[model samples]
Target: MTATKADRTPYLPQEPDLAAPLRLFCFHHAGGSASVFSGWQRALGDAVSVVPVQLPGRERRFDEPRIRHLPELVNALDAQLDPWLRQPFVTYGHSLGGLVSYALTRQRAAAGRSIPERLMVGAFPAPHRRHALVDADRLDDEEFARRLVDLGGISPTLRAYPDWLRAAASLARDDLALGLNHGIEAFEPLPCPVDVFTGDRDPLMRENDIDEWAQHTRASFSIQRVPGGHFFPWDSPALFLELLGSAIAHTGTRRASVA
Candidate 1:
């Protein structure tokens, strides 16, 4: 059966910019919406186009069913993003989104498709590393909420709204299951350069674990520690953006040097 036009729209909606030289596909953390990257275009200016990837069951896609498995999620994204792959693009994913970006890049490479110019991951460790935090999926609601709060995953606004909290918690559990339980048996290093960013104080991440990402990338690998906790991107948008801009700039410089 043919999918309808509504089904064809990319999960994240953005004004089309065919002329932009580079595209930065931004992926959000667990239970996060594209709104997490709202106003990034204005912040980034015209040198690069900022495109946020919206996962299902959140914000505008609230009606869609949530996907719990990493493979399933990235497969769906691969289909939606195939057309956009012709352009020079990079991916920036935070936490769970980082895994999604990395997995998607590998999936594309395995299929001999166009891969991103760069991969920027934040607040996530290498795929082979086991998560050190307690399993929130196994916790009772009260404990789950408290754990999320401790991880800075839950906000005060979410606490005030029972309906929102329930929905958010449900999505978060699905993501946590995928991130923590799923293990990759065999993996190949990616061809593109990788830049990893992590919060200095994020409890879920460790310097050694973050450094392990270097082994998964055959190209240049770099890691930077920014200030704040797990939600550092939200805590310090200016610093995060500065780091992001520098990464993008470095990619451009390298490409220019090679040319």
Candidate 2:
């Protein structure tokens, strides 16, 4: 039997209206939590309900063991998301979350299941072209933290809190391991539309790699660039929200035509 929403509550700490016509599932970057997308509901307003996916070993699920492998992580998420696929929804992921979103979509397609109306991938290259910018998983604690700081994933304020830094480093290592170790053996084009978001100054995602995402989807594909680094959504929420809102509108229109 499939699990109910309550049973899957741990995976999705922020619950939205199950009956909401349009659901926007947001996934966070490495070393991040659902809290990263907190308050997005208010930002996007009622037309779309924002539901943030909370991975294990972070935030409220801190006691749970972290998932270090891509396949394992995607399987766990697929199970939890199965029941929630009843309505029109979109997947919005940043960095590592983008990779997870794409993998999960492929998993669903492999099972002949419903896919997202739109796949919004932010700051992540297409799977086939994913090359590690930094091998955080192999780095020592201090070096890992330094890499995070350099990437804008760690802030100066976070550096003062040793305990928080250690915890973030641990989560980052596991997430980075999943990303670095996962290899793209084959390329399968998706049926759903894809929107790729990048930052003008993001050094990790090369322009050529971002453009290559077009080859992964037979459906409509587009790219938008904002004025920041890898963490542009955090630095420029207004611009990010504008782009997201436009994508949601486009998806909504598609849903109407299908109905």
Candidate 3:
């Protein structure tokens, strides 16, 4: 089940190890891309393959129009990621990514399709609660960009690039709509385990809201507070890698080899 040249797609920039013992399908925060996980392979060693899921309108997918709703993005991912789903894997998403990952899993469960071994969400609020920044959706382009930048949603260094302001704001606006426009929906809890974490200093993801993730999964649930702001994983790469690696070394399919 090893991937071939034909399996490569813009959605997944890196070659995948279908043969690996485990794979982690990562989704990036709004305004971010698969490049966020560029060093993850070396950081985690060969034990697990880190495959970042690049949503449209960012990175190489920049030419494509952005998807503004949650369901549409989930459906698109359902088809694009079918090949990688054949192997044992988990899903780790940050911020808006966490919401996308959760929606995708719920869709798979409803269809009796393959779901992740574990779902790990960082710096995100639980599904049912309206995200704290949902109101930001109403801001004008300029104000919107500034607000996101201040909240650490978009990097300040990107400001050097002339287009970063407008481009980042556009990407963030469309991506943010995935969660902002969608009302909460309830379903039978997922059959898989769910691990949740929040940045200790993040303004968007309150610690209390993180615990609500427990209601989304019927299996074992865990929550921890990591150091940093909304972008903790990048701000504290070593610590984040340590915590993430520990979560992967669980009594599950990660230990089981593919034939």
Candidate 4:
């Protein structure tokens, strides 16, 4: 089927803020929707235009088939968001979304496009490392659903509806599959600042492995171990935003000095 503009785009509802000095493109976790970053603009203040990106198959894009390959999705994203990317922006991605953000950065860099001022990767391990969810294809349906539930990803209310739980689980399975099979053998270190955020009790990323991200960037690198589990961005939105704001501020300061 020929894809519509809506089908081709991954970005979701975000009020236009042309005057905002900075643009923040937020990528959600696997099985998560753009709604995850709803109202972030107000919380972050007028300085930023909070643009929440929705991967296909969730929320507003539910009818659009999900891209199960990382490179494919990254290419599409780079094409769709090319215009906005030329402006000053930052990115924050959680879990599977972190891989997307990172890959997208590389995609833009390869094409000589403008990249983000700062990249905030949260609740995910370094892209080069083989993490626990790498073998998602091996897990059976029941086992996978249980794992998603155990991770506190799906809502408790979804349990009341077994069909909803199953749907959520299936989406998560596909999302994980893409990340596991991202097929990135070469690591071209990024040019911009890369800040890593981990949940204190994250099941996906180990504290010791957090340092691995330092090798992915030539510019500034920092790590923040914040409260909550893998879903800390949702669990502690305020704390995450505070840290994010500070990281972006530091990036802006550095850019000013270089200019």
Q: Rate the local accuracy (lDDT) of all candidates.
A: 0.80, 0.83, 0.82, 0.80
- Candidate 2: where is the Cα deviation over 4 Å? 1-7, 253-259
lDDT of 1: 0.80
**Which tens-of-lDDT digit does each residue in 1-259 have in candidate 1?**
3233344465657743667788899988886778889877887778888988888877778888888888888788899877776677888999988888988998888888778889999998887887654266668776776677788887867788888787677778776766855666488888889999999899889878899999888889999888998988878888988889889877762321111
**Runs off by more than 4 Å, candidate 4:** 1-10, 253-259
> How does residue 161 of candidate 1 score in lDDT?
88
Residue pair clashes in candidate 3: none
Give per-residue CA lDDT, model 2, range 141-245, as digits (tens).
988888788889877687899898888887888887778757675867888899999999998988787999998888899999998999999889998998889
Please rank every candidate by lDDT, starting with the best: 2, 3, 4, 1
Report the lDDT of model 3 for residue 60: 76
Ranking of all predicted structures according to TM-score, beginning with the best and ending with the worst? 2, 3, 4, 1
**Cα deviation of 129, candidate 2, in Å:** 1.5
- Candidate 4, residues 38-110, lDDT tens digits: the string is 7677778888888888788987788989888888888888888766665688999988889999999987777
lDDT of 3 by residue, 1-259 (tens): 6456776677887767756788899999888888988888888878888999988887777888889888888898998887778778888999989999999888888887778888999988888888876787678887888888888877788777758688888888778888875766666788888999787889887656888888987888998678988888877888888888889888366422111
